[model samples]
Target: MTEAAGKSYDGLPGAFRFAFSRSNSWLFKLYVAVALVLAGLVTIIFVFALIVLIADTVDASDGSISLLRSFFVLVGLLVVLPILAPVLFVARRHRREIGDDTGYDRRLASTGFLFIFAVYLGLVVSTPPEQQTSVDGALGPVLEVLYGLPSIVGLVPPVVAVLVIYGTHRLSR
Candidate 1:
Protein backbone atom coordinates (compact mmCIF):
# COMPACT_ATOMS: atom_id res chain seq x y z
CA MET A 1 0.00 0.00 0.00
CA THR A 2 2.61 2.56 -1.05
CA GLU A 3 0.06 5.30 -1.29
CA ALA A 4 1.04 8.90 -0.62
CA ALA A 5 0.56 8.54 3.08
CA GLY A 6 1.96 5.06 2.95
CA LYS A 7 5.09 6.16 1.13
CA SER A 8 5.72 9.59 2.63
CA TYR A 9 5.15 11.19 5.98
CA ASP A 10 6.74 14.58 5.38
CA GLY A 11 3.62 15.72 3.54
CA LEU A 12 5.63 17.50 0.87
CA PRO A 13 4.17 18.52 -2.45
CA GLY A 14 2.70 15.59 -4.30
CA ALA A 15 5.01 16.07 -7.28
CA PHE A 16 8.14 16.12 -5.13
CA ARG A 17 7.28 13.00 -3.24
CA PHE A 18 5.95 11.26 -6.32
CA ALA A 19 9.13 11.74 -8.35
CA PHE A 20 11.53 10.63 -5.65
CA SER A 21 9.43 7.95 -4.02
CA ARG A 22 9.87 4.37 -4.97
CA SER A 23 7.45 1.69 -6.04
CA ASN A 24 6.07 -0.07 -2.97
CA SER A 25 7.97 2.38 -0.80
CA TRP A 26 11.28 1.41 -2.31
CA LEU A 27 13.13 4.66 -1.83
CA PHE A 28 16.60 3.20 -2.37
CA LYS A 29 15.82 1.76 -5.78
CA LEU A 30 14.09 4.93 -6.85
CA TYR A 31 17.31 6.82 -6.19
CA VAL A 32 19.18 4.32 -8.28
CA ALA A 33 16.73 4.73 -11.14
CA VAL A 34 17.26 8.47 -11.18
CA ALA A 35 21.01 7.99 -11.22
CA LEU A 36 20.79 5.61 -14.14
CA VAL A 37 18.70 8.04 -16.11
CA LEU A 38 21.15 10.84 -15.48
CA ALA A 39 24.02 8.69 -16.63
CA GLY A 40 22.22 7.52 -19.74
CA LEU A 41 21.24 11.01 -20.80
CA VAL A 42 24.83 12.18 -20.66
CA THR A 43 25.97 9.29 -22.76
CA ILE A 44 23.23 9.84 -25.29
CA ILE A 45 24.17 13.47 -25.73
CA PHE A 46 27.85 12.66 -26.10
CA VAL A 47 27.21 10.06 -28.78
CA PHE A 48 24.87 12.33 -30.65
CA ALA A 49 27.38 15.13 -30.72
CA LEU A 50 30.06 12.82 -31.98
CA ILE A 51 27.81 11.70 -34.78
CA VAL A 52 27.01 15.27 -35.71
CA LEU A 53 30.69 16.16 -35.83
CA ILE A 54 31.41 13.18 -38.02
CA ALA A 55 28.63 14.12 -40.39
CA ASP A 56 29.93 17.66 -40.65
CA THR A 57 33.47 16.57 -41.37
CA VAL A 58 32.40 14.22 -44.14
CA ASP A 59 30.39 16.91 -45.89
CA ALA A 60 31.87 20.20 -44.81
CA SER A 61 29.25 22.83 -45.51
CA ASP A 62 30.25 26.31 -46.54
CA GLY A 63 27.49 27.39 -44.25
CA SER A 64 29.07 26.15 -41.08
CA ILE A 65 27.05 28.71 -39.20
CA SER A 66 23.83 27.19 -40.44
CA LEU A 67 24.97 23.72 -39.49
CA LEU A 68 25.95 24.97 -36.07
CA ARG A 69 22.52 26.50 -35.68
CA SER A 70 20.95 23.19 -36.60
CA PHE A 71 23.11 21.57 -33.96
CA PHE A 72 21.50 23.76 -31.34
CA VAL A 73 18.09 22.77 -32.62
CA LEU A 74 19.01 19.13 -32.26
CA VAL A 75 20.48 19.68 -28.84
CA GLY A 76 17.33 21.26 -27.48
CA LEU A 77 15.14 18.53 -28.86
CA LEU A 78 17.44 15.92 -27.40
CA VAL A 79 17.54 17.51 -23.97
CA VAL A 80 13.81 18.07 -23.51
CA LEU A 81 12.69 14.46 -23.32
CA PRO A 82 15.32 13.25 -20.88
CA ILE A 83 14.90 16.28 -18.68
CA LEU A 84 11.11 16.02 -18.50
CA ALA A 85 9.64 12.55 -18.72
CA PRO A 86 10.80 10.49 -15.75
CA VAL A 87 10.13 13.30 -13.33
CA LEU A 88 6.61 13.77 -14.66
CA PHE A 89 6.07 10.02 -14.64
CA VAL A 90 6.97 9.88 -11.02
CA ALA A 91 4.38 12.53 -10.26
CA ARG A 92 1.78 10.76 -12.39
CA ARG A 93 2.40 7.32 -10.96
CA HIS A 94 1.84 8.67 -7.47
CA ARG A 95 -1.72 9.61 -8.30
CA ARG A 96 -2.45 6.09 -9.45
CA GLU A 97 -0.39 4.33 -6.82
CA ILE A 98 -1.21 6.47 -3.81
CA GLY A 99 -4.17 8.73 -4.59
CA ASP A 100 -2.14 11.89 -4.69
CA ASP A 101 -3.46 15.04 -6.35
CA THR A 102 -1.83 14.05 -9.66
CA GLY A 103 0.54 17.04 -9.44
CA TYR A 104 -0.83 18.72 -12.51
CA ASP A 105 0.50 22.02 -11.22
CA ARG A 106 4.02 20.77 -10.73
CA ARG A 107 4.01 18.72 -13.89
CA LEU A 108 3.37 21.88 -15.88
CA ALA A 109 6.75 23.17 -14.75
CA SER A 110 8.32 21.02 -17.44
CA THR A 111 6.51 22.90 -20.15
CA GLY A 112 8.01 26.19 -19.06
CA PHE A 113 11.55 25.00 -19.52
CA LEU A 114 10.59 23.29 -22.73
CA PHE A 115 9.23 26.50 -24.13
CA ILE A 116 12.32 28.40 -23.04
CA PHE A 117 14.60 25.91 -24.70
CA ALA A 118 12.53 25.97 -27.86
CA VAL A 119 12.73 29.73 -27.99
CA TYR A 120 16.45 29.83 -27.34
CA LEU A 121 17.08 27.26 -30.01
CA GLY A 122 14.86 29.10 -32.44
CA LEU A 123 16.83 32.27 -31.85
CA VAL A 124 20.09 30.50 -32.32
CA VAL A 125 18.90 28.91 -35.55
CA SER A 126 17.21 31.92 -37.07
CA THR A 127 19.65 34.73 -36.33
CA PRO A 128 22.71 34.91 -38.49
CA PRO A 129 25.88 34.21 -36.52
CA GLU A 130 27.14 37.74 -36.96
CA GLN A 131 23.92 39.43 -35.90
CA GLN A 132 22.77 37.08 -33.14
CA THR A 133 23.83 39.37 -30.35
CA SER A 134 22.40 42.73 -29.39
CA VAL A 135 25.55 44.69 -28.54
CA ASP A 136 26.66 45.79 -32.01
CA GLY A 137 27.63 42.25 -32.98
CA ALA A 138 28.72 42.53 -36.61
CA LEU A 139 32.47 42.66 -35.96
CA GLY A 140 35.00 39.90 -35.30
CA PRO A 141 34.27 39.97 -31.59
CA VAL A 142 30.65 39.33 -32.44
CA LEU A 143 31.60 36.29 -34.46
CA GLU A 144 33.65 35.04 -31.55
CA VAL A 145 30.71 35.61 -29.19
CA LEU A 146 28.34 33.85 -31.50
CA TYR A 147 30.68 30.91 -31.87
CA GLY A 148 31.07 30.58 -28.13
CA LEU A 149 27.58 31.36 -26.96
CA PRO A 150 25.79 28.23 -28.06
CA SER A 151 28.27 25.75 -26.58
CA ILE A 152 28.22 27.63 -23.33
CA VAL A 153 24.51 28.31 -22.99
CA GLY A 154 23.53 25.15 -24.76
CA LEU A 155 24.77 23.14 -21.78
CA VAL A 156 22.93 25.04 -19.08
CA PRO A 157 19.43 23.65 -19.55
CA PRO A 158 20.34 19.99 -19.11
CA VAL A 159 22.55 20.72 -16.15
CA VAL A 160 19.88 22.84 -14.53
CA ALA A 161 17.23 20.21 -15.10
CA VAL A 162 19.46 17.55 -13.60
CA LEU A 163 20.34 19.68 -10.62
CA VAL A 164 16.75 20.65 -9.90
CA ILE A 165 15.22 17.20 -10.24
CA TYR A 166 18.16 15.45 -8.64
CA GLY A 167 18.15 17.90 -5.78
CA THR A 168 14.45 17.36 -5.24
CA HIS A 169 14.83 13.61 -5.45
CA ARG A 170 17.71 13.40 -3.03
CA LEU A 171 16.15 15.83 -0.60
CA SER A 172 13.04 13.70 -0.55
CA ARG A 173 15.17 10.76 0.56
Candidate 2:
Protein backbone atom coordinates (compact mmCIF):
# COMPACT_ATOMS: atom_id res chain seq x y z
CA MET A 1 0.00 0.00 0.00
CA THR A 2 1.03 3.59 -0.56
CA GLU A 3 2.34 5.60 2.38
CA ALA A 4 -0.88 7.60 2.41
CA ALA A 5 -2.95 4.43 2.55
CA GLY A 6 -0.75 3.06 5.33
CA LYS A 7 -1.39 6.23 7.31
CA SER A 8 -5.13 5.65 7.18
CA TYR A 9 -5.10 2.69 9.54
CA ASP A 10 -7.15 2.39 12.76
CA GLY A 11 -5.70 4.82 15.31
CA LEU A 12 -5.62 8.41 16.55
CA PRO A 13 -2.34 9.06 14.74
CA GLY A 14 -3.95 7.88 11.54
CA ALA A 15 -6.94 10.09 12.19
CA PHE A 16 -4.66 13.06 12.74
CA ARG A 17 -2.85 12.32 9.52
CA PHE A 18 -6.10 11.99 7.63
CA ALA A 19 -7.57 15.16 9.09
CA PHE A 20 -4.44 17.17 8.44
CA SER A 21 -3.36 15.74 5.06
CA ARG A 22 -4.86 18.59 3.11
CA SER A 23 -2.37 20.99 4.59
CA ASN A 24 1.28 19.93 4.34
CA SER A 25 2.57 22.82 6.41
CA TRP A 26 3.02 22.30 10.12
CA LEU A 27 2.53 26.05 10.55
CA PHE A 28 -0.86 25.93 8.89
CA LYS A 29 -1.84 22.89 10.94
CA LEU A 30 -0.87 24.76 14.10
CA TYR A 31 -2.88 27.73 12.96
CA VAL A 32 -5.98 25.64 12.41
CA ALA A 33 -5.51 23.93 15.78
CA VAL A 34 -5.26 27.27 17.58
CA ALA A 35 -8.25 28.63 15.73
CA LEU A 36 -10.31 25.59 16.63
CA VAL A 37 -9.36 25.83 20.32
CA LEU A 38 -10.17 29.53 20.44
CA ALA A 39 -13.49 29.04 18.72
CA GLY A 40 -14.41 26.17 21.02
CA LEU A 41 -13.56 28.26 24.12
CA VAL A 42 -15.60 31.22 22.91
CA THR A 43 -18.55 28.97 22.13
CA ILE A 44 -18.31 27.50 25.65
CA ILE A 45 -18.23 30.96 27.20
CA PHE A 46 -21.21 32.05 25.13
CA VAL A 47 -23.19 29.02 26.29
CA PHE A 48 -22.26 29.67 29.93
CA ALA A 49 -23.34 33.27 29.66
CA LEU A 50 -26.62 32.25 28.05
CA ILE A 51 -27.30 29.76 30.85
CA VAL A 52 -26.57 32.37 33.50
CA LEU A 53 -28.82 34.85 31.79
CA ILE A 54 -31.60 32.30 31.60
CA ALA A 55 -31.22 31.55 35.31
CA ASP A 56 -31.38 35.24 36.12
CA THR A 57 -34.50 35.67 34.02
CA VAL A 58 -36.13 32.71 35.74
CA ASP A 59 -35.35 34.22 39.13
CA ALA A 60 -36.82 37.52 38.04
CA SER A 61 -33.80 39.40 39.32
CA ASP A 62 -34.46 43.01 40.23
CA GLY A 63 -34.36 45.16 37.09
CA SER A 64 -30.66 45.84 36.66
CA ILE A 65 -28.01 46.63 34.02
CA SER A 66 -26.30 43.24 34.52
CA LEU A 67 -28.78 41.46 32.25
CA LEU A 68 -27.90 43.82 29.44
CA ARG A 69 -24.19 43.08 29.96
CA SER A 70 -24.84 39.34 29.71
CA PHE A 71 -26.77 39.89 26.50
CA PHE A 72 -23.84 41.82 25.07
CA VAL A 73 -21.48 38.94 25.86
CA LEU A 74 -23.82 36.58 24.05
CA VAL A 75 -23.78 38.90 21.06
CA GLY A 76 -20.00 39.24 21.27
CA LEU A 77 -19.66 35.55 20.44
CA LEU A 78 -20.35 36.55 16.85
CA VAL A 79 -16.92 38.18 16.70
CA VAL A 80 -15.40 34.74 16.37
CA LEU A 81 -17.25 34.10 13.09
CA PRO A 82 -14.42 35.35 10.89
CA ILE A 83 -12.05 32.82 12.47
CA LEU A 84 -14.65 30.02 12.33
CA ALA A 85 -15.42 30.13 8.61
CA PRO A 86 -12.11 28.97 7.14
CA VAL A 87 -11.63 26.40 9.88
CA LEU A 88 -15.02 24.95 8.92
CA PHE A 89 -14.07 25.08 5.25
CA VAL A 90 -11.00 22.99 5.95
CA ALA A 91 -13.03 20.54 8.01
CA ARG A 92 -15.62 20.23 5.22
CA ARG A 93 -12.93 19.41 2.69
CA HIS A 94 -11.50 16.80 5.03
CA ARG A 95 -14.96 15.33 5.49
CA ARG A 96 -15.37 15.06 1.76
CA GLU A 97 -12.12 13.11 1.53
CA ILE A 98 -13.32 10.48 4.01
CA GLY A 99 -15.25 8.69 1.25
CA ASP A 100 -12.04 7.96 -0.65
CA ASP A 101 -10.45 6.14 2.28
CA THR A 102 -11.19 2.50 2.87
CA GLY A 103 -10.07 2.73 6.49
CA TYR A 104 -12.26 5.64 7.47
CA ASP A 105 -14.61 3.65 9.69
CA ARG A 106 -11.85 1.91 11.57
CA ARG A 107 -9.97 5.16 12.03
CA LEU A 108 -13.09 6.90 13.24
CA ALA A 109 -13.89 4.20 15.81
CA SER A 110 -10.41 4.04 17.25
CA THR A 111 -9.88 7.78 17.32
CA GLY A 112 -13.27 8.37 18.90
CA PHE A 113 -12.52 5.85 21.65
CA LEU A 114 -9.11 7.31 22.38
CA PHE A 115 -10.39 10.88 22.38
CA ILE A 116 -13.20 10.01 24.77
CA PHE A 117 -10.88 8.11 27.07
CA ALA A 118 -8.40 10.94 27.23
CA VAL A 119 -11.02 13.59 27.86
CA TYR A 120 -12.70 11.55 30.59
CA LEU A 121 -9.38 10.92 32.28
CA GLY A 122 -8.60 14.60 32.29
CA LEU A 123 -12.02 15.51 33.64
CA VAL A 124 -11.92 12.92 36.38
CA VAL A 125 -8.44 13.83 37.49
CA SER A 126 -9.15 17.55 37.52
CA THR A 127 -12.43 17.27 39.39
CA PRO A 128 -12.29 17.79 43.13
CA PRO A 129 -12.93 14.78 45.41
CA GLU A 130 -16.06 16.46 46.76
CA GLN A 131 -17.54 16.40 43.28
CA GLN A 132 -17.12 12.65 42.73
CA THR A 133 -19.61 9.92 43.58
CA SER A 134 -19.20 7.64 46.59
CA VAL A 135 -20.87 4.28 46.73
CA ASP A 136 -20.50 1.25 48.95
CA GLY A 137 -20.36 -1.92 46.89
CA ALA A 138 -19.41 -5.60 47.15
CA LEU A 139 -16.25 -5.37 45.05
CA GLY A 140 -14.03 -3.97 47.84
CA PRO A 141 -11.03 -2.19 46.33
CA VAL A 142 -12.44 -2.17 42.81
CA LEU A 143 -15.55 -0.45 44.11
CA GLU A 144 -13.38 2.08 45.90
CA VAL A 145 -11.90 3.06 42.57
CA LEU A 146 -15.29 3.24 40.90
CA TYR A 147 -16.75 5.33 43.68
CA GLY A 148 -14.33 8.12 42.91
CA LEU A 149 -15.89 8.75 39.52
CA PRO A 150 -17.27 12.25 39.09
CA SER A 151 -20.84 13.29 38.31
CA ILE A 152 -19.45 14.50 35.00
CA VAL A 153 -19.54 10.89 33.85
CA GLY A 154 -23.08 11.80 32.88
CA LEU A 155 -21.51 13.85 30.08
CA VAL A 156 -19.94 10.86 28.36
CA PRO A 157 -22.96 10.01 26.24
CA PRO A 158 -23.21 13.55 24.95
CA VAL A 159 -19.50 13.56 24.20
CA VAL A 160 -19.97 10.32 22.27
CA ALA A 161 -22.81 11.93 20.37
CA VAL A 162 -20.49 14.76 19.38
CA LEU A 163 -17.85 12.28 18.30
CA VAL A 164 -20.41 10.54 16.13
CA ILE A 165 -21.32 13.82 14.50
CA TYR A 166 -17.68 14.67 13.92
CA GLY A 167 -16.59 11.26 12.69
CA THR A 168 -19.51 10.94 10.33
CA HIS A 169 -19.00 14.32 8.74
CA ARG A 170 -19.36 12.77 5.32
CA LEU A 171 -22.99 12.02 6.15
CA SER A 172 -23.82 15.63 5.40
CA ARG A 173 -23.23 14.89 1.73
| Candidate 1 local lDDT, 39-122, one digit each (tens) | 366557767876776676765656785687568766655655444444454555554453343343243334334434544554
**Which pairs of residues collide in candidate 1?**
none
- Over 22-81, each residue of candidate 2 has an lDDT whose tens digit, in order, gives 544454455456556765786787777767766767766665656676666745454344
Where in model 2 is the C-alpha error above 4 Å? 1-19, 61-77, 92-173
Model 1 C-alpha lDDT versus the unseen true structure: 0.50
Q: Against the true structure, candidate 2 has what lDDT?
A: 0.50
Per-residue error (Å), model 2, residue 9 = 15
Each candidate: what lDDT? 0.50, 0.50
TM-score of each: 0.34, 0.35
- Relative to the true structure, candidate 1 reaches a TM of 0.34
